[model samples]
Target: MDHKALSAHQAMLGTEVSRRRLLQLAALSVAGTALTGAPAHAAPPADKHTYRLTVLGTTDTHGNVFNWDYFKDAEYTDSANNDIGLAKISTLVAAMREERGAENCLLLDAGDTIQGTPLSYYYAKIDPITGGHVHPMAAAMNAIGYDAAAMGNHEFNYGLDVLDTFDRQLNFPLLCANAVDWHTDEPVYQPYSLHTVNPEGGRKITVGVLGLVTPGVAIWDKAVVDGKVRFPGIVEQAKVFVPQMRAAGADIVIVSCHSGPNTSSSYGDALPYPENASTLLAEEVPGIDAILVGHAHLEIPQRFVTNKQTGKQVLLSEPLRWGMRLTVMDLDLVKVRGRWQVAAMGAHLLNANTVPEDPAIAAILTGDHATVRRYVNSVIGTSAAAMSAATARYEDTAAMDFVNHVQSAEVARALAGTPEAALPILSISAPFNKDATVPAGAVTVRDVAGMYIFDNTLLGIVLTGEQVRAYLEFSARYFKQVTGAGPFAPADVTNAVTDTAPNGTPDYNYDTMAGYTERLTYDIDIAHPVGARIKNLRYGDDLIDPAQRFVIAINNYRQSGGGNFPGVTTAPVVYNAQREIRQLIIDWVSEQGQIDPSSFSTTDWKLTANDVPVVIQA
Candidate 1:
């Protein structure tokens, strides 16, 4: 192929992807484009002069198969309603391979693939009939054809035993050099895997895939897996392993990580979205042609600026959580001086709607869905109406109130048989996506299946009344008070502070959201804690005092300083068991079976505009 032909093909690749994805693809050392299903054309044999490669990947798929949130069932049906699942994604992947021989394309995953939906939850929990069987996510992924994948911290939430079983059942390598087996003194994970490609002129290239999990898993999963498993730092591990993989006879290197770079709060207080160490590694480590990132669930369609270390550009991609979109990165790697370098990296969002579902994948997901319903549908409790757990108005609306109340009720009951049980209890909630509209009446299993959708478990923490106020004061981070009368200006959840260490990204400014983005702000007013914006102070039915010894109901993350919630993190954690809030909701619902919205009510948190500027509608 001549220069004109190559340039034409490269341009075609650009139009094939979104403008944002095109920018990420242009950063690649090589170039190529991809189509779905079967191909109308195929490249010539090994003797051809031109070479092409396609890289397909997805990140932050929080186990959403049916499109509807299992908890909400048919009730919740906004954009977050139904979306991507393995079947649709498999169809897309298969089509891409058909468009370009499967041999020329590499199928990979970033992380956070587990621990979001009821299926993942059911897997985390025991299979009621199977004695103790893990979920079928790994099996489905294998059936769908994932060549290699890195470890997302959510995978560790199930413990290494479950992970071991998952590793055994998988045909592809579950690579994660950073996660180690201290007991065996081994790396503990499959470090890397090789993918052979068939390009034009019948040329062949070996794509080296390396996997890395975020090191912060240590703190995030403290209750069940703190000391059992250890993780190597990402930047350090990449510095050592990337070169070794090349020596192992690989043509190109692709970094597969379950982590990504720092991002500001999309809608909550300083959520402190912990990364998997992919961004820092990209800038610090060389030889990595492209990167697949996850965790924090933000999509980077264009080239993200790496740190000052390695200045070379690296293509980065992370589609929105759930099977909402399949992030496709078409990497064109051609031989340069007898070696393969990144020719092009194109990223695009494959709408699940546009693609046909694969039968095998559909069967697996459908079976899992049935399994999920069998357990999830067992009515737990009655709600007065359909309630959601999504956070809203920078505060725990009805949903937060429900989960926190259930936890509080559970903790109170557990503590009822103990001494000093009169202490007031406080629970933690993120106020995330809480604005979900749940009409009054009967509540289904799907509505409560994954109330939080995260692996955060309930904890019983002891705290003083003074510390309690400090904790409440910490939530002031979400306040964006008004200078004058207008509307409630909420906090800037998307503020990527330039002060963050390493690379400071100022590219993302101006709130991209259109409306309902209140600019309400405020100061902590630390001198006063209780009786401030947050109320309903109590230990069971009794009121709370600044000196009372209270057993607070909280999540493991807040118990470990996650929200920087004053005394909550520093408080003594009395109990830490289970894997997800859904399990608790499941138990709560199962004990009741049929739920009405009345069973779930709003907590003490609500919006107030006293002693501040006018509510401005900017």
Candidate 2:
């Protein structure tokens, strides 16, 4: 490729460029323009010199085989509606295969495929894959004809047996070079796969795909994955595999890494574990053509990393989570001395909403979909009053109260006869679903599942009053500082930062405490920055004593250093109920046979701007 062609290719690699513009440039490169108005016929015989290889990938599908949110019991159609699922992805896969001939195309996944929705939960727990039924995730991806898949962190949520079931059922290899069997010091799964494809009249091209997963699995899913398998760093694993793949005669090398791009080592240490190492892998690993990234759940269409040693830019793309986007990478390769070399490459994302859901996919998974729908829609109990999370973020609402009450009660019960029984208990929870609600009638499992979507287990951590106040202060950062004393929209109180952390705080991290009785008046002083937002922190009638110790109810995620909340992960553990929090809520509500909201406080916190009352928008 000439300098002008290289420049145009670089322009296409620019992550900030819109997909439309990238596609336009891709069209120019597809022709023999090379950034110049050159005719295609002027180039050498197309078949003899060049081969166009299209790489299509999906990441974080999370078992959304149908374009429906099982929790909502509705078709996932839009941002407002619940319609994002792999059924929509199936359409894209078929179209991409047809657009770029299936012979020259590769379909891959970056992982987090097996665990997200009620459908996945139902299959993993209810009708387990181990019990004869094929795992829905593997079945769906196999139906779509995936080339290979990496193991995501969530893949280990159900333990090695469940992961093995899904892995065994898949038609393609579930690649994870980093996850190894400690006893033998070898990968439990295949380190990589070599895919040889033959386009019409084109030379055979061998594409090497190496997969790597985040090493943080040893921390997040330590209880399950620990001692069973060891997770090594992506860069460390890549160095070993790239040479092996090269020696194995791979023409083009691609990494299916189930991790985001993070420069920092995992937990701020250089112990071979990095939460995200796609960028580092690209920079450190040589002979890599492209990388498919996931785990962050952000829409990163394309990113280019300049290798520190060779200074060659490696292409990286991360399609947004939940089957929302499909990343496409078109590699312009040329035959050189009987071997194919990548000449120019461009990648872009296609949204699921761009095409209709594949009817064939819907037809294939109808039985599983119906099973989950029937299970989730069954009425488990009733509520005396409707509970809404619409105002839960700005004010204390019954949505959180219900979760906190169940959590606190479960913790107190779990601590019976334990030394921690003497400590006062408090429960901390966050509004996971802002639009969640339960009417004053029958409450189905879906209604409760919508309120608590995550499959987090309950844990009790011992924290001091000072630490509690600090936790609240961190939670209060969710609100943007109100400079003037005036009425503001409820939604406007949120900080202007996006959810992808290392930059912005996610709403899920903003936890609400149940045992403390204090008002979090919206009186955010603009003068005070982060870590100093909460005020009038008290428990009961008197101000909280900084030294007073309390046992707080928390989910396993918070206790496992998720969300980076202070004094929570490091706090002494009083009790660890290896029970899903959602199940606890279901059991508590089912036992009561009703959800009573009258006793739940709706105003544990208030918002005021510098002593002036602020009116909340409806």
Candidate 1 structure quality by residue, lDDT tens digits, 1-618: 011222112112112444334223322312223322222123422444445566778776766555445655542255643356765566666666666576767888877666676677677666521234434566567666678877787777766676667676666788888777657545777888877775655457788999887766766676656666666677777888889988987888888887766532222233333344566677778778778777756656535444465666676777655665666666655577777765545565665554445555555456667766776555444565555533344333456566666677677777766663665565555544443444454444555644555667778878776666556554543444333333443433212233231232221111010001111112222123223543444444445466866566777765655533456555676656653565686677667655554444433434344433233231
How does each model score on lDDT? 0.58, 0.76
Candidate 2 C-alpha lDDT tens digits along 372-425: 899999898999988888777767788888888888888888888988888888
Give the deviation of candidate 1 from the true structure as CA RMSD: 9.2
| TM-scores for every candidate against the unseen true structure | 0.77, 0.88
* lDDT: worst 10-residue window of model 2: 1-10
Model 2, position 557, has a per-residue lDDT of: 73
| Model 1 segments more than 4 A misplaced | 1-50, 75-77, 80-82, 126-134, 183-185, 198-204, 263-276, 304-311, 384-399, 416-422, 432-442, 484-486, 489-547, 589-603, 610-618
